[model samples]
Target: MDLTVIWAAIIALGLFMYIALDGFDLGIGIIFPFFPDDSERDLMMHSVAPVWDGNETWLVLGGAALYGAFPAVYSIVLSSLYLPISFMLVCLIFRGVSFEVRGKANRTKNLWNLSFILGSAGATFFQGVVLGAYLQGIPVKNGVFFGDAFFWVTPFSFFTGMGLLITYSLLGASFLVIKTEGDLQRRMHGLIWPLTLVLIGFILVVTLWTPMTDPHAASRWFDSPARFLLYPVPILVIVVATFMFNAMRHQHDSMAFLLTIILVFLGYIGLLFSIWPYAIPGAITLWDAAAPRSSQVFLLVGAVVIIPIIIAYTTAGYWIFRGKAEASTHY
Candidate 1:
């Protein structure tokens, strides 16, 4: 058994769970300005309040798993992209604090609101930037990061940051459609189609841009026989988008959110496929970066015991909090 492979799968699953869960709440924060009515904003925040913090659990899991399972990747990637990662953490901190303080402030409510918006957007943008920088390839030499401090800043990284903003905004809107009612719900419904179209545009741009600019990615998609298996990814994306559009048109509340998640899943699969076998894309393969076999075995034992508990609690929290978020409910 390749413990390295198992650990890689665990980290991937953990990161996706974080994206799928926390992305919506961050999206809610991003789109907060669109629904300027205080009551509507309250509803939006409340919609995710119960699960927002819990949703971040997966992020912590992913980070810890990476440090344990692939310490080299952790050190090199962090060193290469320290600025963006640090900014992301700071933004998340501010965002988390705003979540609590915004509800209590009266005279300063607007200030907190701004904080929340900036925090969420800043965190999300930096995350996307990190992803773009990673995809572009982190320079590594002799198991150390060999890149400049600002290696993460580029036109492509900024484009990806904007792309993620749109992606999360759509997730936030679709989620609100399921959680709010009447005019607010209708407004969210209105936002969904436009956001969906914009998301598709971004996906198309990335699909074309990645292959054209990154020969490794281009060859992975075009020159390999794996192309046959990978062809359905975009087709599935189109099909999912169509269903999401119809779901919104018909006011199938939950279906829109569910299908949006499927869209995210497909995109996630595409990204993993694009960088297959590389922990630091074009730099280090997973096997080369993995921790010692004994260390992985020990961590795997703990992960096996702990992951199920996290999943169980996460499931319970959502199930317990399920249903429309009442406007009167402030969290």
Candidate 2:
């Protein structure tokens, strides 16, 4: 493969890792608002306490890979997404800080709790909004950005944000089904069934509207392949997800959680395949936006070295932390 292609694959892999790891936490954040009680919320947070930050490393790696491998696409995305991007980062920051401050500040526990929910909600919403904007094709002007900030945050985009949150939350709850025990685990699976149905509804609505909104996507679904023939992917996803969900219901924790991870990972791969070559969804082809080969090759060396380290540390950390969930005790 060419340098650009090779590096793009690497970045794609990093993105996959990010979605599989940090995605559950982000999904948890998205579902936080729906949590009814304080202890339940603490238990929810506890499910991710062992590895949330580590999961975020994939995000960092993806961002770094973008900067190093495709400077043009990176610039365009940043310029076009400045507002939503800032909002997302602020949400991450507040959510993270609240994790610490919530435990220590006796009087301000409620304040920090609210902050955590706000941060999580705000971040999750904008992330979905950003994806919607990208899928819808951002308005790229001259070399510099000129569009208004609200240009990307439409009703459709907002709905997409909600959809992503729900989807991820279901994934996270399914995760807790395996990672946790007792009443908490039982309760989490109860949420997953209804949540999965709701997520399916979201997918239905989005898929139905996608053709009218973005014709390019329709070509992929319609013109590219016979719908019946392409059923295997989703069929497998459903069957496997059903098996995992059922396994969790029966308290088969490891199989349930691992399958849940595979479900999310496979779904991510599908999305990536859907958006191949187009970094900005019809705005620019991956090849067109790729950086210099020389630059990519040089960076690949460092990436080749550091990526493994990141993976090793991340893997080792999770293996060490693997166990039943406990009440979140503030970081």
Candidate 3:
């Protein structure tokens, strides 16, 4: 296999880690507006506070890998996604700061809370928009970006943003059900069904729309060889979703959460499969956008040494902090 393909897989893995790790915390932020009670919010904040910063490490790794291994892809994406990415970064800044500032400000606790919620929701929405834009396609000409600055701003993109908000809320609620107890757990349980339904609706829409909108994607799944590869994906998704619902119904909170994560993972695998060989989704192939082989080799060297360390760090951190969070458990 080419170094380009190897690096692409690495970056994809990193992105998935970021989504599965930081995603629930971002989901927590998205659901912040629903719970008006200060004590409940505190518990929610405490649930994510210990690990939020570390969770973002995967994002940095993913971006860095993309930039180092495929400068052309990075440049094109940076140009096309400049505005939304900038806004997302600002939201992340506020969201991160709110975690630190919330505990310190007695008088302005509400303000910080608002910051956290808006930042989380805003960042999550824009991220979905970015994903939508990629699904639709990034306009490029001969390996160069040619789309307008606001090309990502579209009806489909906004629809995706809304869908992600619901999806994250579902994830956040499921996580709370696992990490909390009593009234909070019950409240999350009550919210899970509707959120699960909404997420399923979004998934259905994307599943249908993705194949219909892109001929390449359609053939990738429906054609013979790739078809065999992908045929089980939807079936697996259905099974996982069903299991999640059954677990939720039985108040198996941990099982429900695990199934939800599996469901998301299956969806991600399907997406990556549909867009295989393309880094920018129908625009740039992995080889075409790859940087020099020397650069890839250099980066691969560091990645080989550093990636394991990061994995160890993340695993140890989670292991150390594994327990149900309480309202008094402030970072």
Candidate 4:
């Protein structure tokens, strides 16, 4: 395989892993506030606590690969996405702090809960904006992300943020099904049908709007043979979503959550397929943005050593903690 292609695949795989792994944790954070009581919320938080921090390993790896393998794309994306990224990072910091402080604090479960909700919502919104901005394309010229603070501002970004908020919340709810039982499980299963509908609405609106929002992307989707092949992505999303809805309605939370996750995964793949060569979509192709092969190979050795260690530790931690979560004080 070509080095550039190989490197691109690594980046994509890393990103997919980030979404699949960190996704449910982020979903847990998003859904934290939605549960009816503090105990249920605590259960949700505990389920993710063991692996949540380690889940970020994929992000770190992806960032490293982007910097090492595709420097130019990294520069453009980071430049354009700086504000949202900063906001998201701050929310993450506060959220992580809340996790520790809540355990230590003698009182004020209310305050900690507030922190958790705000942190989750803020992080999720920023992530959505970043996705929207990436798809909509930044106003870059001659290798710059342009100057306006509003460069990333748009209606599409707004919808994207909302969509992901629902999407991840559903993911969290799905997890609740898998991890909890009794009243909590019933409530979580209650979430599936409505959330599934909302997600569908989001997809419909985005599909209609992306054309008007980014014609270049619209061209790729609306144009001939490419367009025809692309239909299956949305079809799969719909099919999986429908199946999840049925499962959830029937009280099969585990299967419901798993299938919903599969839907999101396919949607992610579709997004990647839509813009394969361009790291920044309309900005730089992977090869043009690629670093030297020697550097990538050097990093690959370190990655091989590091990634497995992280995975093993993460797996072990989860296994140690695994079971129906019961609400309690800090870890």
lDDT of each: 0.91, 0.76, 0.88, 0.79
Task: Give per-residue CA lDDT, model 4, range 17-112, as digits (tens).
Answer: 777777777888777766657667777888787777887888888888888888888888888789998998999888888877776565787788
Segments in model 2 whose C-alpha atoms lie over 4 Å from true places: 33-39, 141-146, 225-231, 328-331
Residue 291 in model 4: shift from native, Å?
0.9
Instruction: Give the Å shift of residue 300 in candidate 3.
Output: 1.0
**lDDT order of candidates, best first?**
1, 3, 4, 2
Cα displacement (angstroms), candidate 1, residue 202, comes to 0.7
Task: For each candidate, give its TM-score against the true structure.
Answer: 0.98, 0.90, 0.97, 0.93
Where's the lowest-lDDT run of ten residues in candidate 4?
A: 322-331
Least accurate 10 contiguous residues by lDDT in model 2: 224-233
- Judged by whole-model lDDT over C-alpha atoms, candidate 2 comes out at 0.76
Candidate 3 lands at a TM-score of 0.97
Tens-digit per-residue lDDT, 1-331, candidate 3: 4898899889999999898888899999999988999999999999988899999999999999988999998898899999999999999999999999998899999999999999999999999999888888999998788989999998778888898888778788889988899988998988887787788788878888888888878888888485787778878877877877788778886886777778778778888988887888887888888999999999999999989999999999888888899888767
> Which residues of candidate 1, in runs, are more than 4 Å off?
none
What's the lDDT for candidate 1? 0.91
Per-residue CA lDDT of model 1 for 20-135, tens digit only, reads 88999999999998778998888889899989999999999999999999999999988999999999999999999999999989999999999999999999999999999999
Q: How many clashes in each candidate?
A: 0, 0, 0, 0
